[model samples]
Target: MLSGMKVGKNFWNGAEWYLTSWRSADDPSPGPYRRALDTSGLPDNIVWEGDAKTYRAGPWNGRWFSGIPEVLTYTNVMEYEMVISPRETTYSYITKPGGPLTYIVLLDTGVVRRLVWDADARAWQTYFQGPRDVCDTYRKCGAFGLCDAGAASTSFCGCLRGFSPASPAAWDSRDTSGGCRRNVKLDCGGDGATTDGFLLLRAVKLPDAHNVSVDRSTTLEECRARCLANCSCLAYAAADIRDGDVRSGCAMWTDEIVDVRYVDHGQDLYLRLAKSELPPPSSPQAFPTAPVVGGSVAVVVVIVLVLVLIVIRRRRGSTISGKLQPCLSLLSFFFFFSSFQFLRLLITAAYANIHSTLDVPGARSCALSFPCIEHQLSPAHSVTSSSAPAPIVPYVDLLTLREATGYFSESNIIGRGGFGVVYEGRIPDGRKVAVKRIIQSPLLDEGGEAFMREVEVMSKLKHGNLVQLLSYCKDGNERILVYEYMKNKSLDLYIFGEDPKLRDLLNWERRLEIIRGVAKGVAYLHGLNEEVIHRDLKPSNILLDDNWKPKIADFGTAKLFVVDQTNPTLVQTAGYTAPEYITERYLTLKCDVYSFGVMLLEIVSGRKNRNTPTLLSDAWESWNQHRITELLDSAVAQPEPELLFELDRCVQIGLLCVQQSPNDRPTICAVVTMLNNSSSQIRAPKRLVFDAMTEPRLREADHSAKEGASSTSNGSHTIYLS
Candidate 1:
């Protein structure tokens, strides 16, 4: 199609216009592939091959197609328009005046391409193309399956979180048509509050909307409520994302979701799941003992039979009645003696094998040694171990960890802090991992209970924004943790480092996404059954994945604080510590909120808050003086005019979080709500004053007096004062 041409249908006249591909490169005959406009439920461009759908350009979502996020890059070269009315519907595009010529074409292979004339090159350059990758194939992953072209697995299809393959055999055979099924069935029949919750899947193309319910008048929260009220609703998403923080309009899906895949700059889809399946399951119960007991019994019986055979052979010649009684007595005596000795040997072997398998010292009890049965009975290994359950957290051997990290070479170190040092390593399975070796200190003690506590806490907590704890090691005096490696490292490198190029990469939209992600993570921590307070929340603790998604890290200083519990502890970083935590030694959920507030302002300004009055005072003054724009990082390009309001709102929220009194600051949950809902009113923040020199000097003196006190060169240091 040319730049100024239109292709669509006129309902009143019963006339239509579309494009068809040639039968061959040299032949002009119409082929099986055709490109046409589809207005069934939403306006979109679809490609068909012999009446079978092949590809779908996602529905028009205000600025661009929902699936084709690349359209934003081409806004300067051309403009697209889609019109829908009772009389007619059409789609067209026009190149900018005095710009190079541009046009689109459909190939016989069912691929679509847009070309632009290049004056210097003397040829047409391909500006964009569709059916771009494997993920673009129609229903590539089947129903409820998410397709990721960049996944490390050989197959590009995987079931969504909280779901399992409907047909495991089919999935193993590289067939994903069976899709997935919920791990825990939803409970929609509750009398009061429903037990169903939604899992948010971010940066994904919305599923096929042919059977969806679209209401442009309702807000996202209203959409969520409506979906929760109706049992048939399966998922929901925002119909539009044009506004900065106020995403209006609702799109609800009642049928099985299909054709969902990851895309750049995509929207979020919340899938309804049972509450029971939301949290990670507790560590698996101790290994079953039935297998061990049964194996030992079988061995004892075998020994008894062998002893009887030996006794019979030795007394074979004594057939007389007088000798028969003596032979029988000898057999009985041998059977009992052999059984006892064999049982002792079995237990000894079991103990040794268990220690080797688990890499734990002093595991002398036979009850926890079931894993050794397979090694003892090599012939019946498969039969003896088929029913055994896997351990939730596997124990890594010191030798394996040493090899992974090149014997703790200095070059392999990724980060170092008060707790320990983190090294980047690749395990035997060819998966990249971050290995943290705990520093030997008196605080952990010889029992290593502190290490276990950290592992237990991390194992139970599961969220997309939280760094996942893969496995751990506790051998002798060594304590280590393994985590999924993040390619982009931490937020501090980009926002507060010396590289201007990296700082500029974080545009306003990306920064907003990071802020929202961190907020959700903190809210999750506070909303847990036993609330958690991250005494140290800073830019250095927020790690970014390959996609730049933020994941909260460094849980060494985190603590589980139940409601009304006053477990006062002094463990915090310099700048991110709350006022009450520092002066009164009081730790609460609000303390984390305060730390988050400080980090939020630091993120916007791209500056560290290590100095007492620099960041907080500057932010407060900027808000009151109506110079919020001046607070933005100079490295970042100015945001669009439409985003200025959101930039100002972020500064106001930051101020509210840093109020002198903990009660005055909003809860982390409330902070998340404020960030998402632009309509929510924000109250003015209370004034906070810092005795600049007094606080810094006091902190330094306190550190010198305390034993085992160490700090990093950067002000982001952790202080552990008991």
Candidate 2:
């Protein structure tokens, strides 16, 4: 069918129209394959092979087909429209003016192809084709099965978390058609306090829409609660993702979820599972299994040794004050063991010290004498110094890090932050890396704890826009973190630095891209199973790669909020700190939103908010005065006429983010939608709490408050700005 053509049914006339394939290449008769619109529940395009279904284009989720997230990349070339009413239900698309001419055709093989006219090549070229991959086959992974075409495993199908193959024998032979069954039965018939929770599956296509319930009025949290209350509800997701971070509307599955697969830019699905199947809460203070096991073994060994000693003493006829002698012997044994351990540590330290002083290349002399002394130390010994769990990331040796960064040379330094100095380095394998060395302080233990916290936080997060933590080092008193290096440095360099060449590189388009990238990263953090609030979200913390793509960095101050945990340790930068955080000592995901808004404004204006004491007030004034154009960065050319509306919209969105009350601010999700879709309506932002007074005055008052009280009367933590 050509663009704008429709294949649907007319309810009033009871007439239906659909596309049918030819019998064969040479035959004109209708074939077995037919493409039709299925409106039984959610509307989807289905390719039927006579009596059986072969392929599905997934349901429409406002912006694009749930299974065709790639459509977002080509939105500029065409506009899709869907109509659902009593009269008819139809779907069509119109090519944009001056864009490629496109048409879709159903082949006798049951494959659908979207072809576009290539004027330069003077031939029709394939724009898209489906089933595009093995995963696109209808129910290829069966019910409740997830299909991942890019999975490293030989098999493309696997059961979801908390579930197992229903027919293990069949799956053993490479047949997963039977799908999977829940490992633990869900608690449904309880006193309304059932121990059932959700397992969040991120960036995945929503499941089949059949046997689904949707409510547009309810929020995602409400939907979750409602689904938890229903015995049959199996999964839930946001029906409409266009709303800001506080996503509204609900789509719940009451029956088997089918045709699920991973896709880039896809929506999140919350699959119900028994609480026992859910992952344990992540905590930096959690104890490691190795230490506990080692401790138990050590205790048994000590008890056995004491008993042996007591028997020997009794056999020797040393009966005078027997109990006191045994106690003294036990104490003496502990002292001797501790001294032996101390001596071993001292020897290892001395060898390491000698090794450092030597200039010998590829030396094994020290290793021959001390061979694996530190490595042989048990976890029990390590736990005596610190109870923190072992980090998930690999541990790099201190010597290796030293060689990578030129013995921690001053010439290799890349950047510095509150926690430590970052140095540019290349690993032995030729991979460039950024090494953050946390400077040792008198509070040595606190520094080590913070280092572990950052490592733990970054290890759990895996996203394109967040910097990747590759490894860490905890040799002696040194604590260092190694991350994937970003060549473009940080966003602050381009937007707020003194270099004109650097400032010119970030035009409105790049700034917009960076803004959107940061928003998506923050949204991902906030949407995590255990929501994370990036206590620090300034531009300096945002690093840019060669392509100028932004990656959120400096997660040392990030805080994970578990259930009922609202108060975060007060950590703030002067200008970006949210008013609610400063004045009321309250914190939430909204704090990051507020900081993002300030950064957004800074990107647009090319001026630091801290330097420009009235940046917020000025933006609000300029917006109201209809001179918002004046706020645009003068370092670059003015935005094109077409982009003027977007420029103004961003300014307005930023103002909305920095609203006086946290409740009034839009969620990061909403901010993303607003930034991406210019048509999305945005309410006027409330005036700033310090609209009458400049930032300097506010800072002065904050200083006074800090000196007056250590904490607020309501038991909330006091804010501390650096």
Best-fitting candidate, measured by lDDT? 2
CA RMSD of all predictions: 23.9, 22.3
Candidate 1 Cα misplacement greater than 4 A, ranges: 1-391, 556-567, 691-694, 697-722
| TM-score for predicted model 2 compared with the true structure | 0.45
lDDT of 2 by residue, 619-638 (tens): 97787544778899988888
lDDT of 2: 0.72
Q: How close is candidate 1 to the true structure, as a TM-score?
A: 0.45
Q: What TM-score against the true fold does each predicted structure earn?
A: 0.45, 0.45
How far in Å is the alpha carbon of 172 misplaced in model 1?
Answer: 37
Q: Model-by-model lDDT, in order?
A: 0.71, 0.72
